[model samples]
Every structure is written in structure tokens, then in C-alpha cells.
Target: MINAKNLTKRFGKVDALKGLNLHVKKGSIQGLIGPNGAGKSTTIKILSTLVIANSGDVTINDIPLKRGVSVRSMIGVVPETPRLHENKSARSELRFHAKLYGMSQKEAKSRISDLLYAVQLEDAADRPIRGYSTGMKKRVALALALLHEPEILLLDEPMSGLDPVIRKQFKEIILDLKEMGKTILVSDHDLYTVEELCDSVTIIQDGKTVVEDTIESLRHETGSIAIELRVSDDSTMDGLESKLTSLDCVTDVSQKRGWVIVKVRDSKTDIPVVIHTASNHTDILEAKQTKITLEDIFLKFAGGHHG
Candidate 1:
């Protein structure tokens, strides 16, 4: 439901987005991940029409994004910081947001109740936001953003500075929203959560996309794939490493902590030949397999370029 082509944004001499290209399919939760100062918030601002881009084009739900297409009515935004009035009750602030969306009192009240319950802030709804904790205030902010049930949701580090229990609860809410089929674009530092929730992702580094793909596809594409080849004896390891390195897909080999760590250019599915080769040549114990994750991909790509 969102598209960007050669999208570039700059501030002073530094480019925040450098020819960035993005395509997010409808009904999928797409995660945007990167380290600090990687232009994530800059991109979000451009999409939400909060900031203008210097060059390139964007389209949201079939409307040219630069043409002032009432995107506010069609999108929900949960900013990194909650900006709520200090003295107003949470319920009143949400009701005001509903009114901004042209909601009637009955509609506003109904939505307020639903959001309060949704964010687990029902008890705090009547209390002034000045007295609410950071988590409670954020809940109210999210509720205000969702007051209109917009088509697309943009969350910037949605789970920040909360305890583990609240983080889990928030993750569940994001998953529940995904089930409800709102196209979501989330940027988070928590790689585990991103791996769990994102259907696809784009990792940016130094204002450029370093990698973009499904979690599995990316894991396969970026690094030297490998599988474990365990053997009880150290006498045969040199032979195993030499044999594995000679294979077509295998790029490197090493023995670490008494396990044969072989690196290849392809998937672990294809590494059994190396295992088989090792097994036929020596006494074998057991082998284990592992897949690279989003964090691995991030460290490989964003970490290097950003550093």
C-alpha cells in the first residue's frame, strides 16, 4: 500500500535518505530496521507527510503522496514520543482526537472505551495524563492515533522503555492488529520482535537500503551458510576442513569448540554432502543445523556500512 522510487531526503549537507526505494504490499506487516541515525524516522516523516522530501516520488494507497492526498484520514501514526496534554484526562484527549476525525460524541465515546480496553488502560482513562506513567501515556497516544481506524499504521519504535510484561502485551496488540489486516510499517531496535512479527523487511544503513527481503530469503542471500559436522576425534578435522573447502558451495571451513564449522555460499540443505563426506571419512557423532536471523543480517549489513 506504499511505494517509493529513488526517494531522497537531505538536511544541510548530510543525506537522510539516498535514493531509497521501498514497496510495501497490502495486508502485510513490513518492518524497517536499522541502527541509530540510519534515517528511519526521516523516512517515516516523509511518508506521514510531516516532512517533505527533496527528490523522488511516493504513493500511498494509489494516490501520489506529494499531491496532498488526505493521507491523514487513511493512516495511523504512533510516534516515538507521546505528546499528550498534561492536565487533560486521557479519555478527553482521545475524544478530542476523534472529533478531529469528525467523530460524533457517541462514536467518540465508543472508540475511547474500545481503545482504553485495547491498550489495557481502562482504569487510567479517567485520570489526568499528567499523573500517568510513561507506558500509560503512550497507550493513550496510540489510542489517539487509532481513533479513526485508519488503513495503514506507522509505528516508530513502538515498544520503548517498558518492562518485559508490558512489552509482551504490546507485541500481542501489534500481532492482533496484523490479524485485523492493517498494513503496518514498524521500525524497531528489537530484532527478536521484528523477526517474530515481520513478514518482510528492509534494512537501511547510512541512509541506503543494504538488504531487503523476507526473513528467510535474506538469511540465505547475505552470508556464508553453514552446518555443523561433529566428530569425536581431532585427528581427522584437517581432512574434513580440506574436503569441505573443496566442495563447490563451501567457501570456508573451521573447527571450533570440537565441532566442525563449515561455511558455504548456499543453504544448509545442500551442506549434507559435506556432512556425508566427513561421515564417510571418519567416525561421526551428531550434527546440528541453524538458520541465520534478522539480527545476523543486520550485523552483517548495517553494522559494517554504518561503522
Candidate 2:
């Protein structure tokens, strides 16, 4: 439903995006994640029509981003920091946007009522936005974004500053939007939320895309299991790493602090051999098995290359 190719943008001498590419399938929630200054916000801004790219091609629902085509009506945007009228109540805010959207009074009222309920701010819909908490303000922003019932949503850090309760509620609302067949592109630093919410992810670095694929495919390609081993003797750690590296099942082995971290392909078969091999070197202090997460994948592909 959304596509961008070879998108590049520059401000003075610094390049915010250098050939960054992204794609989102219809009815799927896609994640855009990277380190700070990796051009995530810049990408979102260009996609939302807030910033024009220096050179690139973009389309929303097959509508090319050109002077004559109208992509704004097809997309809703929830920025990292929502800018709302502090004095206006949520209901009034929605009402104002509804007018800008060209909705009649009856339609605007009904739509505004539904959105207030959807964001769980029905009781406080009439309260001034300035008195609302951060989470409440975000809810208001979300409601405003959905007031037009756009086909796609571009969310830049939607989970930022939200409490656990509000975050959970926000997640549920996003899932509900997916079920309703809305295409979503979320740019967030919260990998856990991305793992839970996204069908696929695009990791970028230094203003370029490093990798883009489904989480399942990334896990399989990057090795899913990690074996963290702490040995009784610090001297034996180096020897253990060498032995684990020679094993066919182990993908990677490295030492950190007093622990030897090993990435393995098959946990069931590899874990035992890994433990047994370490036992031969020295007494085992601790051996724990963990699944490699999105964060691990992020560091593997996008880390150590940042300027």
C-alpha cells in the first residue's frame, strides 16, 4: 500500500537519507527501526508529505506522489510529539478536523463520538488538552488522525512516553486497526513492541537500508538461540570460545566480561554439546539458554556502523 525507493534527503552537508527504501503491504503493519540520526524521522516526514525528498519515487496505494495526486487523504500521521491546541478539548479538536475533512455536522458529530470512545477518552473528551497527561494527549492525537478514516497510518514513535497501561491499550487499538484492514507503517525505537506488532521490519543505518524482512525470516537467518555461558575460571573462557567456534552447530562465539556468549543454530542438539564442551575446559559457573531477539538482530545489522 506504501512504497518508497531510492529516497534521499539532505540538509546542508549532512545527509539524512541516502537511498533509503521502504515498502508496506496492504493490511500489514511494517516497522521502521534504527539508531538515532539514522533517518527514521526523515523518512516518515517525507512519506507524510511534510518534507520533500531531493530525489526518489514514492507512492501511497498506487497514487504517485506528484503535484496532481492527493496522498494526504489516503494516509493518517501520528508524530512522535503530537502538536495539539492546548486550550481545545478533544471533542472540539476532532470537530475542527472533521470540518477540514469536509464532513457535515451530523457526520462529524457521530464520527467524533466514535473516535473518542475508540481512544478510550470518551469521559474526558470535553476536558481541555492542556490538563491531560502525555498518554491522554497521544490518545487525542490518535483520534484526530483516525477522524478521516484514512487507508494507511504513519506512526512515528507512537509508544513513546506512554505508561504500561496506556501502551498496552494503544497496542490493542493498533491490532484492531490491522483487523479492520488498515495498512500501518510504524517507526519506533521499541523493538519489543515492534516484535509484537509488526509483520515485517526494515532496519536502516547511516541513512541507508541495511535489511528488510519478516521477523520470522530474520530469526531463522540470524540464528534463533543464544547460549550464554559463564565459566568458573576467566582463563578458560578463551579456550571455550575457540572450541565452540569449531563446532558446526554454533554460528558465533564471543566473550564479554566473564561470560562466553554463543549463538547456535539448533538449541536442542547444540545446547548440550556447548555445555559439555565448556565442562571439559573448566567448572561451569552458569549456563543459560535464551532466544535471540529483534534487538540482537538490530545490533548485528545496524550497530557499529553509526557515525
What TM-score, computed on C-alpha atoms, does each candidate reach? 0.86, 0.90
C-alpha lDDT of all candidate models, in order: 0.82, 0.90
lDDT tens readout by residue for model 1, 1-307: 9998788998999888998877788888999998888888888888888889999898999888865567889899888787888899988898878888899999888878988888888888888899998878777767877889988988888887767887888889888888998899999999999999898998887787777778878877755466777887888888888887788777657788888887666564567787778888888897876666687688777877552
Collision pairs in model 2? none
Count of backbone collisions in candidate 2:
0
What are the runs in model 1 whose C-alpha is more than 4 Å off? 223-226, 229-243, 251-260, 263-269, 277-286
lDDT (Cα) of model 2: 0.90
Candidate 2 lDDT tens digits, 142-184:
8887889998999999888888987998899999999999999
Q: Clashes in candidate 1: how many? A: 0
- Model 2 — which ten-residue stretch has the worst lDDT? 62-71
What value does the lDDT take at residue 122 in candidate 2?
Answer: 91
Winning candidate number (lDDT): 2
